[model samples]
Target: MAEEWRRETGGRRTSAARERFERIYHTLRDRICLLDYPPDTRLSEEALAEEFGISRTPLRRVLGLLEAQGLLKSVQGVGTIVTDVDLDELAQVYQLRMELAELLGKLSPVMPDEETLALFRAHHKRSLGLIDKPDPRTFARLNMDFLQALLLITGNEPLRDISERLYFQTTRIWLKLTAHMDIAEEVAVFSREIGDILAAVEIGDLEAAGYIRRSHISMSFTRLKKLTI
Candidate 1:
């Protein structure tokens, strides 16, 4: 009985640790994606550990995960630095994302519940507001939220994981380049995408929704390429 109790306690501890790790990892990754920690921004390990109330060991693990995701890199003398995205890398990743977006429907697609559809409707409404008051940061966050809600409709774990990683990997590019691009136009296009995706999902057409996302991704990449050139 004592041995069983110890095993259960260990399992709980492991779960808690995992939860903590994920929380920290996501927070840091979001900051990177949002450009709060822009390209080449050096992250202080000690400061982050103090901020999260965690030790260096676990914090290092979180940093390691971000590094693996192409969001951060460790320098020999410098600490973990947020990596920059160039047009070439963006092109490659965007191509992969376009391909995977369609797979969201074909591979184990899960029809979203009404509540999920409602959330998408909320995204559409929020996107409409951006057409007039186009705020890049707010739009970036909305994009993240919409992506999360969309991923929930797919049961393929690998697809979801790669889709999200590639998303954050390329998301910062848009925000970073907003100065040179047409904010209103981009927002308008994105708003249309949300509406179309929401409409597709509303009628129980997961495959159509995936195709819609793919089309937008391709168009978005073309726009981005023009700007980069």
Candidate 2:
């Protein structure tokens, strides 16, 4: 009984550690996406460990994962630096995202529960509020939330993983250029996309929903390219 108790205790500890790791990863990722840690910003491992009240070892693991995700890069002399965004270089990545967006519904798609659908409607409502008063950071957060909710409809693990990674890899691109772009127009476009997605999901047409996502991605990329040029 004591051995069993220890095993259970160890399992709980492991789960807790994993949760903390994921939380740290997401926090760092969001900061990067929001451009809080802009390009070439070197992360201080000691400072981060101190801020999180953890040692560097576990923190390194989190940073390592972010590095693997293309958000950060290790330099010879400097620490991990946030990578810069380039639309031209990432053009292929955007194309891949557009292609994969169509698969969100094609591969083992799961019908979202009512709660998930309601949450999407909530996202749609919130997005409308931003159309007139566009806050790029808030809009970005809302877009991220919408993506997470939309991913629930995909039951394929690999599809979900790759889709999410690709999403994050490119999310910072728009945020990086918001100062040069018309954010209000972008917000309006985003609101419409959310509305269209919700409508498609409401009628149990996830395939249409996927196509809508693909269309928006393609259009957004086109807009970005034009802005950059």
Candidate 3:
């Protein structure tokens, strides 16, 4: 009985530890995305471990995950640093996002179930409601939520994985570029475009949805270019 109890306790402890690690990863990723950490900032493992109330082991694991996501680079003797924000890389991220979105549009002919459709619509509504909010962090999170919801309709595992990664990378670039601008109008326009795309999907008009998706991404690239210039 004691042996069995020990095994059960160990399983519970492991699960709790995994949850904590995930929490740390998300918190740190959000900080990086919002530029709270900023590009090229030296990330001291000890300092981060202390800040998150975690030890080096789990902190290293979290850092490894971020590194794999292209958010951090670990130098041999210099410790880890936030990856440089290059305009070229940002453009590449936008291109990947556009391609994934187009693929998702083509796959929309499969028609997601009613529950998934409802979730997408709900997220769209939430994004619309956040338009007037001055908080860029809130706006960024809601925008991600909306994109994630739309990506779910594709039901392609590999595409979903790529989209999620591209989403974070693109968001990091976006927050940096739009940090000083009042983007309320831009957010409103995005929300409306999402609604139009959803409407097209509902009617099983995959072609129209694809066109809108491409146009939306192209316009975003154009706007971002203007902002950076």
Clash number for model 3?
0
- Taking all chains together, each candidate's TM-score versus the true structure is 0.93, 0.92, 0.78
Tens digits of lDDT, candidate 1, 20-109 = 877887799889999999899999999999999999998987787778778899999887899998666887899999999999988998
Clashing pairs in 1: none
- The digit string of per-residue lDDT tens for model 2 on 1-229 reads 1222233234455667767777788899999998999999999999999999999997987787788778899999887999987556689999999999999999998998899999999999999999878998999999999999989888887788788888899999888788899999999999999999999999999999999999999999899888788
| Candidate 2 lDDT trough over 10 residues, lowest sum | 1-10
* Alpha carbon lDDT at 198, candidate 2: 94
User: Any runs in candidate 3 off by more than 4 Å, and if so which?
Assistant: 1-21, 50-54, 107-110, 179-182, 204-211
lDDT for 87 (candidate 3): 74
lDDT of 3 by residue, 102-159 (tens): 7876653457578867876886787678776746777777776777667655656667
